[model samples]
Target: MQSTLYPKCVLRGLATTTAIAAIAWATPGLAQESEDPPAAGDQVAANPNAIIVTARRRSETLQNTPVAITAIQPAALEAKGTLDIGDLQGTAPNLLITQQPTGSATANISIRGIAFADVEKSFDPAVGIYVDGVYIGTSTGQYLDFFDIESIEVLRGPQGTLFGRNTIAGVISIRRTKPTMEFGAKVETTVGSFGTWGMRGVLNVPIIEGELGVKFFEFHQQTDGYMRDGFTGQRLNSSNSENFGLAVRYNPSATFDATLTLERQDQTSKPYFASAMVPGDAFCGFVPPGACGGNLTDDLYTAYKVAEHSGFYKADGVTLDMEVGLGAVTVNSITSYRDSDESFYADFGTAGLFIAQRPQTYEQFSQELRFAGDLFGGFDYVAGLYYFESDYELDQSTFVFGAPAGGIGVIGHSESYAAFLDFNWEVFQDVRLSGGGRYTKDKKEYEFPLILSDSVKKSWSKFTPKLTIDWRPTPDMMLYGTWSRGYRSGGFSGRAGTPFSAQTPYDPETVDSFELGAKTEWLNGRGTFNVAGFYTDYKNIQQSTVITADNAQGNETIVVNAAGAKIKGVEADMSFEPLDGLNFSAAVGYTDSKFNGFIIGQPITRPDATIFLQQLDYSDVDPIFAPKWTLSLNGSYTIPVGEADVTLSAGYRYLAEYDQQIAPDPALYGALLAQDFSATPFVVPQNDPRVRSDAQNLLDASISAQVPMNDSGAMANFSLFVRNLLDDRGPSFAFAVAAYPNLWHYGVPREPRFWGASAGFEF
Candidate 1:
């Protein structure tokens, strides 16, 4: 497949984006959750038109919940072609999902002013991703399918006391549809741009009516990439994936219920397209001719190469949950286990001149037990004890094509134990106070037989607390304030690249958060408005820096901690139904963050194949992945067309630019760091290294119709969607290579415009 690119503008914008992202990556890894999931069915909201979220471990309307959160349901996901959390990028305020140049599976997600940017097996996630209430342990495969999902909820800020460890940034909670006692089957298919084709199906079985039931879902999809290898006339970034799952539920009585779900996912794809690139009008003295023309960020590669033939990912998991009535209290249990394996290779130079390899395997198990009930004076409480364990192994390697590779192998295990309790009391008819706390103990171990002192061990324990106060002036409005503390456990950067080992583990990062908010409803149930402001005092910030050593082996990397950081932000979302059949929603956010102290790190490479440190000043760097301003707007209209209801929807998003500058000119880099390292640096005349990515805006639209299917209340629906309707493009994440910065500078282009049709039936 060939892509239609707006080269002239893209090249100009690509330069700025690449520089800023590079700086961000080397900074903190804070990931507040992103996006807004759909509301839960018929719960919490008295208005009957509000989104209900479980962000606080209880059902409540989004507008009434004090915490900041966003939600999206399956309907909106299908219409927008959202297959995973990554696809929600831009649509959500202050949310950024940047795919690693290596592969989409290995990526970074930033919410608000926080991010989990570094790509390493041992690095813990600043943001916790939970599926069906089970924590996803690794970054190796978080970009998977969202088959048969009920909703996705993105919670922002420090939810330490409630969500447990490593939720310093926030959490993403995903819920799947539960089994229904009905006999039915349905299937949907779609074909679209880039030779893309897909099918999704669901089957429901009624074993004993309401007493016992089971449901099954499956998906198959394939797509030719948007780019092609000009050398071999083959597709690049192509993918094939399959997913299936089964869920069973048993409800013997009104007060007791149990559910078990088993699922598996597999994916195979060609590595991302990579080819050496140079600015238009720049001389291609050492590169191919066309590489210097077009000023393209994405290279229409002249060659095809992959050390691993085909990239692959595989995973399977099972979850069991039960609830039983114990006198006046309810007891609940959640147990789960998951395993995954992945291997992939890509061209580091985009010209296929260099090759890279990354392979990993991991497994996790978790168990939680909690009790909840209501007591006197409108006092409500929930208490739980939780246990979690995981094991991981990874192999990383990189080298020039047709040459020996330099790399490292890492293996490790982790364990966590925790106990928590939360209580809420209605002090008066219109005032409420809530308090919660959690204590956790964690331990980790990593071994590398190749290194003489190979084994690394670390442990930590902490008590996190939170307090909230709410006042309801009326049944339709609320004002709230909260104070909370969140913690992310420290770990060993004992990887193969550098000599840094277990003896000196980095300190855990912590955040002290303060927030204030207001949620209100007007015009009956047709209008909703919410606003929140937050400030976070972050300490012991984790950071990754390059360490260059020109020897028999290549460059390596190690991570350390910074003094601290301070972040302040505000967000607002509103929805209104002014017209009889029309609805409008809009959201905006602003953030300001500082490192709090001087920051001096090493220079980052353009090729990105290795981490080689070249002393540089980072004292004035902006916050990583935290845009100054974000805006989004969406609206939909529905009208009756004969016997069917037809609807039209449109949405738009914009992100204000933040600093993303680094070394872009090889000559300038040589003048800046090469000489300082006592090594020869490439030099050029009047070199310019300062670069930036401008603000970006995107638009999307969709149309759909639904018709009834007999008296059984079944329905068949069809829809058409066009994403990136304006064909916005250029650069999102751009960079230059260390070995050949000037000749190898390039960027990851945003997806081109895409149009597709979908049809599905439910009975």
Candidate 2:
């Protein structure tokens, strides 16, 4: 079949091109004008027009920034149908942003090879996500709805020196549409499969004509999940979410600008159904929601025994930014605060008797002051100082063996401070050299109420640096090489499999990276091409260790900093206009990542607190979700249909397979079972689907037309779109927790074929 051949062909072709992926996944969603060609929809806008960015914390053209960054304009975002942040997965090379297996309103954002799925109260994600210059404090609510967005920038590789904090791997920066003086409004709605319905609206008002303006946006979407329950006939993994935001912009004078934004999101959803290796119960109302994940019914069946209250997540935030330009120098200030709460209950067995619930709260506040200008006649410089504080709390609860063994609450707080400097020296006209450095210090404290002597405190410090050399051979072409270092803070974790009292803080992580790349333009701005090669020296890799619960059935989470690791990759992007009304774009990324040393752990300890074996050596594991290859191709053609102009676009993306978790082989799992229970000779299922998923292909297409209403410039359009045209459902994430008689494989399922139609008008 074509589906089978597609995977095989793409796997073989990945190496033939010797090309890897881009940083920060950015899906192209906006509608592009026929006159301009676009870049890879998976990579960026793909438009032939030049893009402006602030990847280095300074405004400049993307091609002139000398970084492996992709810019997604509003047009590309619309074209790609990226309504949510996680929907942008595969838009960037080597980027994987998937739903957290636990439940809704969470994300696992990875860049290159660094990633984390630890749900502990203190573990930091290697990839940092930012909205309007404000850092998202935790992974709890990073999956945001995209309503009125201006652009999104994805920076690949380590960006610590300039971006700071958890950006050891990369950064995803989102810029929302600011208020404009001109009045405007747009409303869109969609209906699709599985009882899906969506509505979105935006309004722009000129409160004071040219000096002051306000913009407002809101979005709501819901679906009746793809999976059905075998017992109660209930749905699983369904979602209902709403998001809204308001922004005000003030431009009092020519050189001064200020903006304020407020936003809120509320999401409610059911948990992913668990597939059991050993079926325990298959009846509805057999057990409460606190305990699940034991009974096996069907691959897509979910057992719902209790009242439906699975997941609830809410987030609110506010930001203020001010900028002043004085001749050749500019000063900027950013202040923001965000709060989020996540509460969820998920079934483990098809019978719905064995379930788990988690409640978490997160709050963060930050401030940054920056200055940029030309110095020493030939040097451009940017310097900044930043401060951040946050509080996080989580409770993991479960009903195991007819007992309440959960309700263990963990709370954590942290404060971070940093100072940074960056400079670009144009020493020889065409040859420019840039360097930057950041010094950061972080302090943390944690308290686990259920565990004795659980109050913990620690601190971390690091200095990251970056240097780059760029050669602009022509006005449209540049070649650059960069060497840089990145850092991620370390803190106490409560999710480890070990006893809460035995868990310790993991060490901080760091990475040294080197990149060589070229950016070029041809055919008089009709075509553009860029490629890059990178190597990373990764150290103190933080891995989540799985261990048998001393007195329970499922495995527990432990955070450990394994030895080290290495990653190398290459990527290329091309976009061009071959004919009038026709545009084609392609981008690909290939990565090679592996652990450097061993991960030794204390051997099997029983609920009686007695050791049964010595520490074992575990090493050379693959990076989680670090796919080996990522490829994207897209094309669009325009045609005149009566009095309206019509455009048809199609795109395809392939994501290579990678490990979903640090899972164990069947034999190793048996050994762990022996330590906890007297079960010997236990072997895990070899064909369990929860272990991982193979590489998969995704296809999407859209058709839209713009019909000019009158000479007054009013416009209206309609669109028909299909995402996942082939209906490929490969696991986006998988988890195999040792659940006594069965090693349960539960996860967030891949999206199935979804089609929708929409129409909107702008006035």
Candidate 3:
């Protein structure tokens, strides 16, 4: 374990070296032309054989572009056994997605410490998700299952260069496998311990003289619960899911093509309740052996129970894309409709007393249109217009003492329209200049429906602009600088906790960012490296405030922009093959984020006249959940045995400790920092200081043997695979308790090491 401890940046050199070696071994006898290595002073052209990416709204080779991006093709995903978007986090640098303790339905995506502060209907994710160029409006609908996908592109850093709002961190673009000229199908199934079972299949059917094609895919997964519930005599934290998708592609002619795709997913899981805290150190001496803290259910079980969850999500849309060769001009149009609904029970409790009866729901829709092409020698550009409208409604009904004492609900509609333009000038063959701007007008309206006297609604608007310059002095290197702006619209509040406080509305938040980056390919594309540094100034940061819900008229607390914050960081990514049959990739990111200026005080509007001695706030510190450093390394080797192949993969991930909450109140502050706050008697058990960061190593290996199945070139392969062979427990969470330091409890622990085997045939 003490082998050379190289940071992610240093590891880049190693990966590059390995890649160069691989290229030489791969093309030993290939003919080399005078321009085979690319002239030192010429601009690097894209690989003619590689699939072109439309990340910048144009089809271009990844190597030829100056943007910082990571592309995962379908073949690579299958080889790595990645089943969903979340699984790619470990494989990609500067990207992280972790379960929110709530459920897998909601995932927290972090990029360069920029993320969505809220995960509710009224708020949107900081990273934009696009499928076939259609923007996904809500995070709730972002949990898409993979099936016959062509590729996934992750663009790091702000994407205002081409993508619009909500792309503060970056963008995730999923390209689904389109209808092909020929027919093909693939089916897969796996079974393992804990009664785990999964089955998936895809089929392609060609009809009407190969002019029309249809493809469908279906996937189902189910598993027994890892934890047993004594009271209910049932499984605890069980997981199950069902997903299906169908797409029809029409190629009436070579110049025009249209596709209609529909998808549906159903997921259900049991909730894992939070563990209770133990007494202080003083009682550690007299307390019984089991009562001090080992297992939560050993001593006492609270009557409060968390409700289970079961939900269905459906997404359907039609995309019409037409490309006509009209000299140098290109025109494009896109329109989409998306809708989703989800309802679940949540456990909102303090101490051992559970607050059951909490239910929530949401609905939304959106549309957009754009066009681009080269007009004259002075500039080549794209201009577009967008329109988005969504409606959401949520209800928070709590049952205490077997009665609905606190009931809350809110309905809101948000709409926005914008026009933008981005253009580039070929200042010279080695240098190009680009600039873009957008003007947006947003409006929102909210209604209590059950409480407010006058309809509560408001409208706010803003304008954002961006500029970029790409300078390629050599075919092997590209350098660029950008200045861009990002914005998030205002939103409504949720139910209140206390009675004395009134509902609060938040205003829009905006950020102005400056960045410089470079991409380089050395050793004739055997290895590649990308690095970027950025600084962002944020204003009107939104934060959730817990308030009293005792008023008869109605008590509600909302998410509002309280103050400003700042973030700056450096990120690097590199990959290469050093030895024949050996490939390696690694990514590392360092972020420094914190509040710039802010003040906090007890609200004078509250009816209670109690004077607060002190309050917990992050006015001088960074927001919690922003890890200081993230490093990941993955390597694999393929060995050939006769006519068979065996591949072994090993990887490790290390993360620095950081706070989980934006700011703790008086009661939670001391426990989070592992300090002593005399006035605040309660401490958070899961936020204990001992559990700072998570470091773990994973080993996975697979062996496959291909045997002739028939006279045809087709063959059958049998394989065996194992994951998490060491079965490390990873890290635990810390929580607050009364009169003591934070308590530590592990997360929904991962599955232990499991082994399985499969046999399949391919032609």
Which regions of candidate 1 are displaced past 4 Å?
Answer: 1-45, 101-104, 275-287, 291-309, 494-496, 501-504, 550-553, 598-615, 658-694, 732-747
lDDT of 1 by residue, 1-763 (tens): 0111123223422443343334333332221121222324443435677777888776667766778787765676676665566667655567766665454365566677777555566787778888878777766566667567888887888888778988888888889878886788777888888888899998999999988999998988888867665546676677888889899998755555678889888888876543435453122344455544443333433334433346888888877777655545666677777777787777653454456677877777777777777777578788998877877777766665457567667788888899999888889887899989999999998876545365788899999999999999987899999999999888877454545443457889899999999988989878988888999998987765433334223444455676688889898888889988798888888888877653434444434445454434343466556788888898889899988889898889887765332233444554544444434432322212222345777888899888898888688889899888887665555544333234344545566788999898888
Residues 384-452, model 2: lDDT tens digits:
988888777777787754567655667777889999999999989889999999999999987776664
In order, what is each prediction's RMSD in angstroms? 11.3, 11.0, 11.5
- Please state the error at residue 429 of candidate 2 in Å: 1.7
lDDT of each: 0.69, 0.72, 0.58
**What is the full ranking by TM-score, best candidate first?**
2, 1, 3
Model 3 lDDT on a 0 to 1 scale? 0.58
Work out the TM-score per prediction: 0.86, 0.87, 0.81
lDDT (tens digit, per residue) of candidate 3 on 258-366: 5666766677765554343344322233322432454322222221233553433333444443332222444454545554555555442222222333344443334
Model 2 misplaced regions, further than 4 Å: 1-48, 276-307, 496-503, 551-554, 605-611, 668-689, 739-743
Worst 10 residues of 3 by lDDT: 31-40
Scored by lDDT, the top model is: 2
